[model samples]
Target: MKDLYYIFDPLCGWCYGAGPAVTALAEHAGVRLHLLPSGLFAGEGARPMNAEFAAYAWSNDQRIERLTGQPFSERYRSEVLTNHQQMFDSGPATFALTAVALTEPLREVEALKALQHARYVDAVDITDIDSLQAILGRLCLTGAAARLARPDAQLEEANIRRIGQARQLMQQLGARGVPSFVLQVNGQSRLLPSSAAFSDPHGFLEQVLAA
Candidate 1:
């Protein structure tokens, strides 16, 4: 089996852009797709969504939309970006995804897709536990939400390990950014070119299989 790791941050605009390609890769046979949250936007990296950051994010979002045909909505622009009340933390969403993995591993990616859509499309504050839980509940993932509500030390350790491993991989590959891919086949792992993800995900899988 091939293991493909997509190192991402929940609040990253580029990661959201790579969503469709990642989904396609997830569906490929003989490939075990692992969603590795880097937590890059969590902890000390998080910031308040000020007007300056909002404008900058919107500019970058437009580029992502052009490149990947993903969405950046008016609601997201007005409601999410303009709201000074919300801090840009990836921790809650990361935990929520971790919760999904703990309760229903197969639905982890499904949870992530919903997370992205809620943030980028529906303009929801994904950094809040209540909002994330509500969205997960609507997706029929109340079990995951329940797990999220009562996260134990084990879940925290799991989140740390995931981010740590992903950071190590990024360091090894000299990749500076999120939305990076590492394809592992036959016990050997190598970095997949970033272009393969955006330009041709299926062909990228074929290339990895052939490798």
Candidate 2:
């Protein structure tokens, strides 16, 4: 089976922009997706955001919105972007995603969608365990909370290994940023376009399929 690895962080804005294209590619190709949770905003979780940083992120978000036509509502701005108290770390959400992957490989994409919806649409803080658990519950993933809390030794080891593998994949593909898509076939790898022309999702998927 062909493999398409999507290395991304749930909290990544560009990843959200590329969401439609990625979904189309996965569905059309019927390829197995390996969701590698890159710790883009990892570290000590939340941090105080100064005016300069806030301005930069908001401006970038505006550009993304204009480019992709993805909705970035005023509620999301007021609740998540403007609110400096909430942490922007992607670690907790990534780890929970890893846990979901360990339990059921097929559900990785679903878990990713749920996490993204929680963060972007619902304006929920995904860095918090409670918020993640609540979203998992809505998905009927009852064991997600326990798996995230006390990950089995083997699953923990696998998650760590996957993280390292994702870093190596990033290096191999020469990806410069999060939400990168790499197509590997017959032992050869190719880097798909970044967030250049996101409005044409089918065009992007064609490039991936060709790769």
Candidate 3:
């Protein structure tokens, strides 16, 4: 058996671009996927959306779309990025994923995919708790939705711990960003090159299996 640690941030466009490869790896029988939310744009890291930031993010999003074939719709730009009322925060989404992780562990990636789609394609306000809960409900992840509706100390702690673990792993591996993949086999762990996830998803999986 192998353990694959996926370190990511829910709000990171690059991480969203890597979704297909990560989902494929999660489905593999021999791999145990542990999603660690890096809290990259959560809490104190959160920033209010401004014209300058919106332009920068849109530029980056376009590049990701071109490279990975992921859709960064105009709707997302107009609705999500241009809305200064909503802060650019991933805390709520990360917390919601934690709820899924605690309840329907196997469905956590599914939840992440759905949330990404909701924001980037469907133009939903994913930073909102109500929106997150609604998305979970649509996914038939009611248990997670319930946990999110009334967050407890356990959920909060677990979320923090997951982020802490992800950051620690990043520091240990000298990884500078999200979408970092670390493969563990035979009790040894090593960071996998993240480029293949966007450039050659099939090759990335083959490499993981071979390793």
Candidate 4:
């Protein structure tokens, strides 16, 4: 089986923009989809929401929408990006996904999609543990939700380890951003063309399978 590694940060607009293609890849039977949270907007990389950052994010979000046809709702713009009380952190969401990975591995990407939708479409504050837990529970992933609500040392270590491994892989590939695709076949790994993921998702999937 081929191993298709997807590197992404939950708070990244571009990663959210590439959601459809990644979701399709996860559903494909032949390839084993690995969801790696890069943690780019977590820990030390997290920042407080401010006017300048909000403006910059919205501008970039607009570009992503034009390129990928992913909607960035007005509510998200007002509630999430401009909400000064909330920090732009993916740590909690990453931890939630790690819980899902440890329990229902197949549903990791599903969790990610739901989280993205909650943030961008529904304007839910995914930076909060309560919201993330609610999301997992609503998805009927009770085990994962329970784990997230009361995290153990194993879950903490796993989340850190996953993020470390993802960062290491990014360094190895000289990749500097989220939504990166790495396809492994016969012990060989190659980076897929990033442009196709945004502009031509069908072609991107074809390229992955063909490779």
Best by lDDT: 3
lDDT value, candidate 3, whole model: 0.94
Candidate 3's TM-score reads 0.98
Q: After superposition, how far is residue 89 of candidate 2 from its true place, in Å?
A: 0.8
Q: Give all TM-scores, in the order shown.
A: 0.95, 0.89, 0.98, 0.97
Instruction: Residues 1-211, candidate 1: write the lDDT tens digits.
Output: 7788989999999888878778877887877889889989998878888999999999999998887889999999999999988998899999899888878888888889999999999999999999999989999998888878888898899899888998999999888889888887677768887776666667777766676
Model 3: per-residue Cα lDDT over 165-207, one tens digit each? 9999899888989889998777777899889899777878888
- 1-211 per-residue lDDT for model 2 (tens digits): 5578888878788888878876776676456667886666766433555566667877887888899877666676677777777666777887788778877767777778777777667878888888888888788777766798676887667767777777788888778888887778888877777654277887876666565
lDDT of every model, 2 decimals:
0.87, 0.75, 0.94, 0.91
TM-score, model 4 to reference: 0.97
The predicted structure with the larger lDDT, 2 or 4, is 4
In the order shown, the candidates' Cα RMSDs to the true structure are 1.3, 2.1, 0.9, 0.9
Better of 1 and 3 by lDDT: 3
Worst 10 residues of 2 by lDDT: 43-52
Identify the runs in model 2 with alpha carbons over 4 angstroms from their true place: 44-47
lDDT of 4 by residue, 92-200 (tens): 9999999999999999988999999999999999999999999999999999999999999999999999999788888888887888888877877777778888888
